[model samples]
Target chain A: MKLEMKDSPGQLVAALTPISEYGGNIIAVIHQREPESPSDTLGVQIVLEIAQERLDALVAAIKVQGVSILRLGEERLLYRQSVIMIGHLIHTDIGDTIGRIDATGFAEVAELNVHMPAIAEPSTALITIKATTRSEMGRALDILRSVAAEKGLLIVEPLAGAEA
Target chain B: MRVAVLGLGAVGKGLLRMLAAKPEIGLVLTAVADSSSACIDPAGLDPAAILDTKCVTGRCGPSGLTASDVIDSGAYDVLVELTPTNAVTGEPALTHIRSALERGKHVVTSNKGPIAADHAGLAALAEDAGVALRYEATVGGAIPVIHAIRDGLAGNRFSSITGVLNGTCNYILTRMDDEGLTYEQALAEARELGYAEADPTYDVRGIDAAIKLVILANTCWNLGVTLDDIAITGIDGLTVDALRLAADQDCTIRLIGEVVPAENLLRVAPRVLPRNHPLVIEGTLNAVMLSTDMAGEVTLMGKGAGSVETASALIGDLIAIRDRYVECG
Candidate 1:
């Protein structure tokens, strides 16, 4: 879960109360102090496991404390597929491409390999993307295709009927 | 499962004996090669009878089949590499490993040259081919140090690793310390006992220990380091006087391999350790001490090398692969 809250002494405690009240087990909480970007709120990411029935009440309780929930999802990634991308990978903002898929909280770029021959030549990379299900894999590939098309990159996907 | 073995040395034959002894493990020897020739049989060979014939004839196989031909035969699902160590080129061993992985065959090896030379590259190739490359015997003979670090302490990060890796060096040094013998006298005794090789440069010059250190460091830290990165000092220059002086100081001289990834330092040299130091192993025993975050300091010790001891590690890897394949299926 990613959230935004006012940078105050008791803001973190206030944001975490709902999780405890809803019987959610907190795994870890990452709260890095950085200057406010465009909004006057702090960004925090919390990893936790909670019962499905209490999720609605948990979200409601957090909003009662004026915390903005930026992202929230359960962990379910299972299947993985490895693909290769060839072109000006570095110049095309590879980080942004990965972020777009990861933002969904259902897929992630699990592994990566890149090769660059010269300063002006195109680069090649072997990428492994993992997802929660077969349909999520299709969504991830569709997102990758759009990103690659926008950057004029060539993609060599995993062979059909291949096991990962 | 079908298995092919390359390099029919002592360890190779030992592995065959163990496989024959435990046929329930489901590994069948389909091919085997010596230095000059190879024998291929998809239906499997009688391990005891073959050992007897090779012992009497001085070699095995049909005179002309090479290592490459055995790989190309495509009769096995796994390749066990028991070739000699060539730290300089990692030659035929490296080539053979690459060929097997490219053909999508799992590999279990006791050879350290290929691992010390190009482990990261081979690991990448194995990943691409979707096969497993296991080399537990490349380090401590039967200690299972690799699995201890990679699996048992999977959640912990290591601060440093120190070990007594070469048994031959340890045997020579132990004799020098206990019997007050000179380096030459102890080395001669080691050779007489078959502990030291005829040309003991690799063991005495610290190259063998250094190679094992490289393999462990690369695997543990994913450093992609080569042998040239380490600073090595062997026991060739240590004299009896130094050993006596260490004894006076309540310390014994032992060759130690130390790696500190945080400082990007790897060194192997004769160091004076207190008599009680965990790494101060006696005789041919090998020990590795890993300083971990969650588990404190974990030390593992066992026989470092022998035909049967090394075969134990090879068979352990084979079983691990088989179990994983079953789980995945």
Candidate 2:
């Protein structure tokens, strides 16, 4: 199960409570995010084994805890969005910047690659985000714009060229 | 299920405390065996008297409480072995453990010497007798490295494992680098802090890490690599200047244990890692980094030592075994 949980303390524990209450054994948890982002939401991929009868109760319990269930089946990486950031990424604390983008409710920054020439020079970061839907992707970009404005950085939304 | 703790040392006391706290686990403490007579009480007769009359019931005379006594008594469904590390003279504990397993009882231990030296033989015995030989606390103290590799990451083809296997050595190095202490000063501090043993050779000479590496290599890569195959290096010879130099270059000097298999060469070594590396940030804590072709790199980090942490891992293995028994039966 892939879940998008509110990026807050004890949210992971709250989300897992129902699984344990329903007698679900969590085999593995895969969570990766940019370290510097505090508000950045996290994508949790859990592999669990529970009875078929308890599956509905488990999902209901998670929903009660306000956790967004993104994908229910075996499919991994159900949603993906790519964005480009242009500005002084290194000067503005790249880790914290990534955290802000991830802290948004709609998306998580899964991958980021930055190019910086000098300590004081502006750099560009190619960030790939994962979200539940296209609307969530737009909301994530809005959060990124606010963060960029506050950090004196620039955000360049990806443009799709006309089809041939 | 009733259980008996054979040694009331650090690990033994920790196990007692953990088992006592878990209400879901129907554990009854029936007996205890310790070499020290100073801890035993003869008046109350019940072993619980010594534990403030909380859980333990009967008291065995001493460490001489043989396997036959524990098995024939039929008071315990499981035997916990937390004796000191002595592969040569510790055969009695091994004997008791084997007997327990053969008699259809479960066994949990934190003794690395026996497991490193004779895991195969004991595993076969446990399988034949339809019992469990759980030793999660033996390696990496409390990090769950053994279980994570054996079960959680079992699906992946483990290509290599690199870690700072010894907490004492890591502590010594961390102090030397951070505080500018000399090797002797750091060793003295470690001894004072109870991190290093009185002799300290096992931890300082790299043999400790080698044993852990050998176990991981055997389990993960199926290489059967022994302590002799590992190129062991200690932090004894390193100077403060070298550590400072490494720190200046965006790297930290750590005693890393690595098991790498590429093409024909299988390698295990203790090397330095950059500061940004996850293992470097692990600091005094124990961390194991595993690399696989499919999973890329996965690192598990947590407390490497301490009685409670190690005992918790043992309890986790015990619960898993119990659940499996319930499923199978």
Candidate 3:
């Protein structure tokens, strides 16, 4: 579960109480980005197992504790898709492009290898993305397409006969 | 509980001082050991030199005063190994560690050589003897990498573990890049600042990082890759100009130790990372990043090395082991 909560003292404990109250043992809690950073809110990703009927209660309990649930769903990204994006990747702000794809709930860019020939010329990027389902993979491709259009970069996604 | 310090070096002295401040822990320093008369002088030591009141144990000679001598003396329940890393000279310390484990006494160590060289053997012995052998200070100083991987992230499937494990080399390289200091000047500065050793080859040539990588690899992946399996490249060749170029491109050149298992092979290397990248921004501060299937990428950053910081790790492990023993009982 990916949760976005207020950067306050005891906020993490507040968010975690519901998990324990609902009989969920938290396996891991990963807080990405510093809490003091103004531009970025605290992104907490927790791994826990709960009964299917109690999961709704867990989410509701967390919401009652004042934690904003950004994305809460089953674990995805077990399957991976490797693609090569050939275009002016360097000139087109490749980091922003990659960030957009990662922001989508379905896919995460696992590995990115970029080759730059010259400062002004186009560069090619080899990106490997992990997704849960094929439909989610298609949505991620759409997000990447919009990012590419905005940045004036071309993307060669999902090589021939590699769809799963 | 009575505690006997095996060595009176920086780490051992720091442990004595920290134990003095924590009255709730109910620890008593019974004996202290060192090779020279320097151990006798407790003046100017922090925490008011509580160990000075304790018995001045005999010198750490080659043959006399074994680690078992201190353990068998019946004055301590825990053994803290703070001896310097020399396989031959430190063999006695390892012997003491094994004996303590065999006798079901908890052992905590800040010495990397003993843990890096004999982790599996010692772990097996500790398991067989039903004792705790905790070495959190061996890898990332006080960063809690070992416990974080072994306990915190126990449920995750760890895919890869990477980090900048050596602080001496990182400090020298960061100084050279940030201040345009020559290699000799940086080396001199690191030595003056007590970061680098006299020879400093182990840290500069990536051998130290290799040892840390091996520990993390064994802990996370159970791949059993030894120190020889690492493809180590240090920061000796990195120049200020090269660092500047990397920084100009929104990237930083750090001596990264990476272990990636893909295509049924384990690979380790030092690579350049983007400035926005977590490990690159982690700078001077030691950072270990574990990429797992569930958590994506998790990075932990803190002071990687220092006498007090590393000693604190050792003490934390000691406290944890003690608590576990109480709970078990």
Candidate 4:
């Protein structure tokens, strides 16, 4: 689960209370305090296991705490895919491209490597993203494709079922 | 995090000092044991007083309580196995770690006996119990070679591994090269400087290096190799003339542990390496050359063995376990 909430005291505990109330076994919680966006909000990524029947109730309970549920699933993000992009990454704003996928909360940019030969010339970047499920992985790829198309960057996506 | 240390040797005391130095980390040494006795406190104990008592009284814990009792007391969150290495039987240390894992406690060990003898078995046990059995200090002391292979170079295919594994042997070989001393003369000098043990069969006979190789082989390549599988040769036979001959050729003789997974070969023997070779590290410094497909040859060099150095590795493992617990929660 990915959560975005205002950075305030008791925000984390308020967010976690729903998991316990809904009988979800939390496997991990990656809480980032420093705001990474315009909104002064923290991103909390939680890995958990819960019954499908109780998910709706859990979501409702979490929403009651004024927490924006960016992503919620049965398991943690595990599937990984790497894509190579060649274009004016910095001038075209690669940060916006990554933000689009990351905001979806279905996938995260796990690793990135860039080769900037010159300031004016086109640069190359290798980005590795991880998602929770196979269907989510396909959606992440579609999101990347749209972003790359909008940015006029050539993308080399990972082959089907080849993503680590 | 609560901890139970099994040995009160130099490494164990060094670990206590490190833990005591960082009181804000919330890691408490709740239990400690020497071979003679054991001590336990649900709350944290005063490490300085414990050291003082051990030093002045020559007893680690109260009478009659063994290391096993401290382990099974259910007082510690992780078991710190610092007992001496017994490569033959993997003894008391093996049992200590096993008992901790069986009870669902994580383990961090510097003892190479259990890892060299049954790394696979112990790893399987830890997996079965959903805990960690980390022995980063068992091989390269403070170099973090195991962490480098398992975590830092994750997903890379390791082609080969070569290392100056034993510090005592490296010291003796360095002395022989610098002073043009004979094998026995170098060995005696190393003993006098407290570099080699009084009974230096393990270091001089290549057994220690071979054991470290077995640990690395089993970890990196999943090769279920043992001490018997390694082709061992020591520095005992290298004379001063050989050293001079290598020097004349711009080379130096050093005990090298090589592991080639492609050929299914692992050996610990003296090799005449060029002066510029990464393995030509001088004195007691150890270096491991990890030949990987992606990262190429990554050379990790550091102090191979010392109380504080080995304690640094142990503290790294402990903190890793602590972070794992924080994540798993």
lDDT of 1 by residue, B1-329 (tens): 78899987989989888887887777888988888888889999777777776788867767888888889998888899888878988988999999999999999999999999999999999999989999999999999999998888998999999899999989888999999897899999999999998999999999999999999999899988888998777887655655665565466778888899986779887776777778888998999999999999999999999889999999998888888753422
Between candidates 1 and 2, the one scoring higher on TM-score is 1
Candidate 4 residue runs with Cα over 4 Å from true position:
A1-164, B327-329
CA RMSD of all predictions:
19.5, 19.4, 15.5, 21.7
User: How many collisions per candidate?
Assistant: 0, 7, 0, 0
Question: Mind giving the per-residue lDDT tens digits that candidate 4 earns over A49-106?
Answer: 6655678899999999999999865545667766666678889887888888899776
Candidate 3 Cα errors over 4 Å, as ranges: A1-164, B36-66, B87-90, B263-269, B281-283, B327-329
**Chain B: TM-scores of all predictions:** 0.97, 0.86, 0.86, 0.98
Query: Considering DockQ, where higher is better, how would the candidates rank from best to worst?
Result: 3, 2, 1, 4
lDDT of 2 by residue, A80-113 (tens): 6554465677777888877876676446889876
C-alpha-based local distance difference test score of model 1: 0.84
**Candidate lDDT values, in order:** 0.84, 0.69, 0.69, 0.84
Residue B206 of candidate 1: its Cα lDDT? 92
